[model samples]
Target: MNGGLIMKEVTNSDPFTIVGTEQYNMVSKMNREYRIFVSKPSEKPPASGYPVIYLLDGNSIFGTVVEAIRIQSKRPEKTGIVPAIVVGIGYPTEAPFSPHRFYDYTMAQTDQEMPFKPDGKPWPKQGGASEFLSFIEEELKPKIHQTLKVDSNKQTIFGHSLGGLFVLYTLFTSPRSFQSYIAGSPSLHWNERNILAKERSFMARLEREAIHAKLLIGIGELEKEHKSNIGELAKKMSERLSFYKNRGLNVKFIQFEDECHTSVLPPLINKSLRFSLHSQVDQ
Candidate 1:
């Protein structure tokens, strides 16, 4: 079956709904559909409004994220960490699910075969990230702002794997777009470490100028998929860390010793939310 048909069937089987609150749904605009999950305070919308966390690959991670929020909000001491809304950009279960995402998440197309794809399908469309970023900034953000009681300055963006790569893209290209960024197991190998090069360029262009935002990067200690290249990745990350520190950017790195690529999401999400939440209090 086609991807759209599969999505329709899945939605029919298990419709979207907010678990604890009376708000949530699959929103559609301009041929794109997204699953938005919201969690509002019991009293009502606060005068200051709530913060939002936008998660890429929402269909896979929304439940775990929502559960984490529920557990965090129950604790009196941790109430500050729970965000008001967790928007998940749902993806169809097929090739080129969303042309925008497929393009944005990938790096530049290459002629060489990928380690993950042995059959070699022309490197999956990529390099339209600037335009994809525009879609979120110009289209999606406005929709959320108008519909929800969100604190304009407290928005965060998160991603994993290829999605994580795009998070970095946004961070460098549009640093002011999000107050915080969470990247879990990002594919730093994209475009032969083009992300690292871009970071260098960004730092060079803004030397000694502080970027007022929080960045958290996490990786599984046991993620040895490309064993020979692991040391290089660590070295690149270390270099980036030094650069960010010199620039006075708020940053954190976590290495989960027992986790793998797929296993890193839950803990990463928990830690990222905790960090973002605490930063709010510190401000």
Candidate 2:
């Protein structure tokens, strides 16, 4: 043993900070632990309560989303956007991502969608979007409600790529869970486009009951050639979503010409915030 060596636990501080931010840990029913970061508005909440945005992939982009909210939302009069709370949901890991995302974000795989490993290794087990949605709706939301005054009717959720795929899954399976859903470059080819089946089911349900939600879908133009399958998938999703416009839904599709999959995220966050809060202010 080395002499004069004192070993003690090191207390690490969060690298990202937003005013009025709070951090917590939650364990889901599936036995997965999550890292949750939340930031409420600096100003007093409106009579309607603070709108909340639930974001996936929070491990990597929480700071950027929170920062954007802080800069533009500080003065809503100037920005035409209202102040709201941001809730980032991430996994408890040092890395920016986890392979758990593959299972958590994707639904059941079909025979045609059987994943082939790069080295011809065994395929990874997948399909947990349903249970993950339950964790959000049943456990996570209630926990947040206990701490903050949330306008439940104005809730929104945002995700990108695989997480984006989960957002679409959530909207189709439980349309009333949130007021707005934003998917940025969703992996529409997931499970061999099984989400299309979910879409048909969603439509059937909509026939019996009314649905009220706003959906904003955006993709990076450069991703077309880079993600060849996405071109067809996005087109299909666009067409399917368009059918719901007259059935009490607001749908918008945008392509960010200059941005690629990686670079398009900031604009997606900014645009989602505006889409959720701007029109509400005017109304």
Candidate 3:
């Protein structure tokens, strides 16, 4: 393994330790630095323009999802998936994930959601989701759209765990921000089911402004233990989705068999991608 050192050539664009992709460090006014990756498909985009998937936790899942899209989309006659651009929203850090993800990929909270240490130590700061969402809407989206000729009407966003929570939050608040939303094993118990309130508010918005988008909610069958909150969380999500499905939101629920919370992501990426783009390219 060359003593854990990379023996291959490296470049600034390949900073994510992956090839065939470009990485950039974007600094925001909120003092958060995002390590972004743009992975374009190998084949030429359709005349309708290429679809784009904005991924949270870019540093960890970017490579997996990007490669999945590339491989699956290679043979459309066999795999229904299509080649699309993947925009990963990661942070600059040697670790697998940055501490800032706790804050940036969460909903605004009031209480009952703080993470405390065993000895009751101060938890990491959180609840900066609004700001992070603004960064994506104002700064990141414009930058990406300006550079690439993307099919904005086919935009998709994928997130896992806490990032999944953020995906739901974004969908509820600004449904048009993306055409499809995939939330994998979301931490819905966060803030004592605070996301429900957001959904309630979104219901009111739906009355005034209609939304047309696809939503995929997936969770590992083994994600819940005896005392786990995942079951209740999923119930709330499913119930809420029931109300929105008739209002233009096409939703799907998947329970991955024989997979746990952490192990489900790699496998879910491919399925999520297909679900996200199926309707767009099926015609």
Tens-digit lDDT string for candidate 2 (1-283):
3588877778996665566888788999889889998988788888878989998987888888878888898788887677888898998886877777887889887657564777987556688888889999999999989988899989999999988889889999899999999988888877545888888888888778778898888888788887447755765687777787778777788888789888999888888888887765222
List model 1 lDDT by residue over 1-283, tens digit each: 5765654434446666656543344434345454454555443555777777888877677667777876776663745565457776655543323445666676565544455556754455667666666767887788778877888778889988778878877887678899888878777776555676677777775584667777777788777655545424744664575557555566677787789877888788878878776644232
Q: What do the candidate models score in CA lDDT, each in turn?
A: 0.68, 0.83, 0.82
TM-score of each: 0.79, 0.89, 0.88
Q: Which stretches of candidate 3 lie over 4 Å from their true place?
A: 1-19, 113-115, 226-228, 280-283
Using TM-score, rank the candidates from best to worst: 2, 3, 1
lDDT of 3 by residue, 173-249 (tens): 88989998899988887754578888888888877766898888888878876245774586567667867766788
RMSD of 2: 6.3
Error of 2 at 43 (Å): 1.0
TM-score of 1: 0.79
Clashing pairs in 3: none
Model 2 TM-score, 2 decimals: 0.89
